[model samples]
Target: MTSTPTRSSDTTSSEYDSDDTNQSVHSDDTSSEDIEEVDEVVDNVAQGDPIWECQMCGALMWYQERKDNSRHSTVPKFQLCCGGGKVKLPLLEQPPQLLQDLLFGNQSPATKNFQTNIRTYNAMFSFTSPGMKMDTKINNGKGPPTLRMQGQTCHRVGSLLPLPGDSPKYAQLYIFDTDNEISNRMNSVRTNKDIDEEIVKKLKLMLDQNNVHAKVFRMAMDMLNDVNFQDVKVKLIADRKTDGRIYNKPTVSEVAALVLGDIDSASHRDIIMQGQSGNLQRIDEFHASYLSFQYPLIFPYGEDGYRPSILLRFVDDTDITKKKKLTIMHWLSFRLQRRKGEALTLLCSRKLLQQFSCDGYTMMEAERLNWLRRNQSKLRVGKYRQIAETPTTNNQSGPTLKGKRVVLPSTFVGSKRYMDQLYFDGMAISNDRPDIVARVFKIKFDELMKDLTKRHILGKVLAYMYTIEFQKRGLPHAHILVFLHPTSKYPTPADIDKIISAEIPDPKIHNELYNLVRSHMIHGVIP
Candidate 1:
């Protein structure tokens, strides 16, 4: 066994027990290596001019302190937090600052302060912070009140707007684009000290009674999406300057002013829905996204013989088809029936429905619904089914019921030679709606395949057994489908409006409303 030689006696390997000798032998070799390593480190340190550098740990300590004050400085002591022991790691003073600012990111007194502030700001944007939290000013867990702005626009950048002579809208302007998602929850404070209290009042009302999501919130999100386009457009227009907020931008508080600070002049609603007297001839469904600008201009509900909060369905354009009239008739029929029984109606952008009026049909009072009730029994299922086993669209017709041998149509939409649609109000069936026991569509079946996994409207796939097509006169109309979720995320019409966006859909309460509206509409129009 190996043994360390002691001053008292030359080491002897003969006197250890077997186990003790085994341990002792290993320690002797290790201790010798440790001593050699320490000597080598000391030698390397002696080579530097003033101080020795320990290359292993990259330690630069003063050998001069050891040489000059051999008694005290050479043995500078360091304390262990625990009570067991103390240590001496040698003195290593960092160099004094010369141009510290440039090296330490403290180029100026201002820059030094900026760095500190940046650390604070970064805590919010970055996930690196451990205990960092977004202040109540920026992100209060309780969301802010939704503002209902009458005047706002919802158009994206580079999107085309309807114009004459087709030169294209050369200048993209964002003056009208913005959302009231600008919240009281923002970290920025505004002038209204009682804003929070006011919001609380509304929220309480909503919590206590309102059984639906806030419509205004949906509007705010739509506006926010539109804002991105405006932000990009305005930057280019200003070429990035004070005129553009993308430059040395204002604080969140200043943004509050830019958004909620000013209000526009209020005006007539007809101008909003249709257009100023001479502006409109017909509503162009394709260009309607820009119509957000006209929202405020839409007349208040009472202006056109409709009740308070009710606006004219259409403001301009006088072309109405017999089919459109009948469809509105059926809608009015359902609204009259259900609203009196329950407040059943749909919510959508007023711009889309501005020109939609039945005139005499729309002008009917709630009292008039009672008159229709006299013949309501005649509109019952058993009776109507027998009357309309057949359906007609332009020249296309479904097979007539041969004593209950009704040959269901193979599809709802097809090419001109084949379009077997069964929309309401064709010259066939004497312009009567038929009992639709079954329906199908030929093409664009993808629209009907529902996205089973999605939790949002955009996430859904088109669901169809077969696609149904609807046509107005001979022109294509937007497709109409229904969702009967065993557990739909949106259960009500208002719920649907809040959950979905620009793609507005009308959800009928029961099969009754569904079939009625279906009879009135022509699908296969929306691209």
Candidate 2:
């Protein structure tokens, strides 16, 4: 998740830190089993044989052919290291140039020095060389592309049939095809449109000066929208900045109720919703505890990633103080230790967050005992119920109350589901691909701008904002807010008709245009 400002009161709070920057939690202890195994294998392998090692944790491996060739498998099975990262093998020999450089220490120093000084020395020695004339007729690359921004004049991609009295359609297509010229032009336009730099500058100024008024927030938000969309809207209003409010802070459930319904009368609901909500809700106590171990949601006292915003999803009965203790103690005992391969496997598997929470509650119990022992002198008689109430049984048996604590599931599932349904989420092209969806949106936006500029539409664009969101079914759609140029703004019914249409086009009169419009432009019943 991107970093946002933490509550100002949290800066001095013993419960949580406000200024955590690191995202990753590394293991404090290293496993010795892999090291021993690798050392034993290393002693057996011949000196010149090829060996591969994991880059993450220094685990080594070797390829070995299986004897079961009759099974029809032709590939050798690789023995991977404990680190579970991509394997990289060392090059057996250095390159010729590197070897020469190391042995002779760079013999071309004089040549390098001469080349460096030659340009200036030659300028003094030769007259014409210093005052050489250059051709001024050559085209210096500048200005917008050859294609007009007007939609009517701009040719579509790959329309390559010859015209009757002019250049072939192929030639027109060739201009866009050469070296991906169209893509380059689109990229240039996108760069010019990007207002992130301006937004960041203004945002920093507003934050630093404590001038984050409602209008300032709206201005920053407006920068995220397009300038050529039909309609714009903002939701989820914030009345005031909640930066430093800690003592009088509202709980997550309270805030949710305030936003979603009447806060005074709102009742606690299950974190996970069932049925049509399609949420994995109503998690049992055991499952919730197990989840808490993995995610640190229940006892997130010392967890750097923990935020007050996360607790809003839980039921009212959850013991916040106890949860905090568990989270802190869990981290304290283990200190994030794990087998690298196992950790990775758990991270990527169906169980997503399994490693952090351990089996049984022995470690947690031990931690609690240690704390009780240390604080015995400070404790008021029968003050804390956890220790005072049924003290002997609670301490000995290890927190067996099934419903005593509840954990909410991570938001990862719903988020991934939404992204998976999207037609373009950047990940559609490749694992590492970025901005694919954004690029598609920008291209279509540019086309809209082109149409508006040429007066093919009723009004000129002044400014606008747009947002693309994925539906539950995984399709991507855009919501646009258009700001029209005042001079060309349409106020009458006839003026609106110039750009908006409801009836289907006449196939005979419109022909190709009719077919294109009918095929793509129809909307379903509004209600």
Candidate 1 residue-wise lDDT, 1-527, digit = tens: 33222222343221222333212222333454543443344444332222222222222233332223333221222111100111111111111122122124445654343233322221111101121121324323456422121221122222212244322111111111212122322122223332333333333233223211122222323443674532221110111112210122222222111223223432222112110112222211112111212221111110111112211122132223332221223323222211111111111212113222212232232224333445455434344565556555687667654553322222312323234443332335323322221121222233334333243344444352334535443332234455444565466788768656553245544666655555555344432
Error of 2 at 481 (Å): 2.8
The clash tally of candidate 2 reads 13
- Best candidate, TM-score-wise? 2
lDDT by residue (tens digit), candidate 2, 374-439: 655554434446634543453475555543221112222334434565534434643344356457
Model 2 has an lDDT value of 0.31
Give the range of the ten consecutive residues with the poorest summed lDDT in model 1: 79-88
> Cα miss at 114, model 1 (Å)?
50
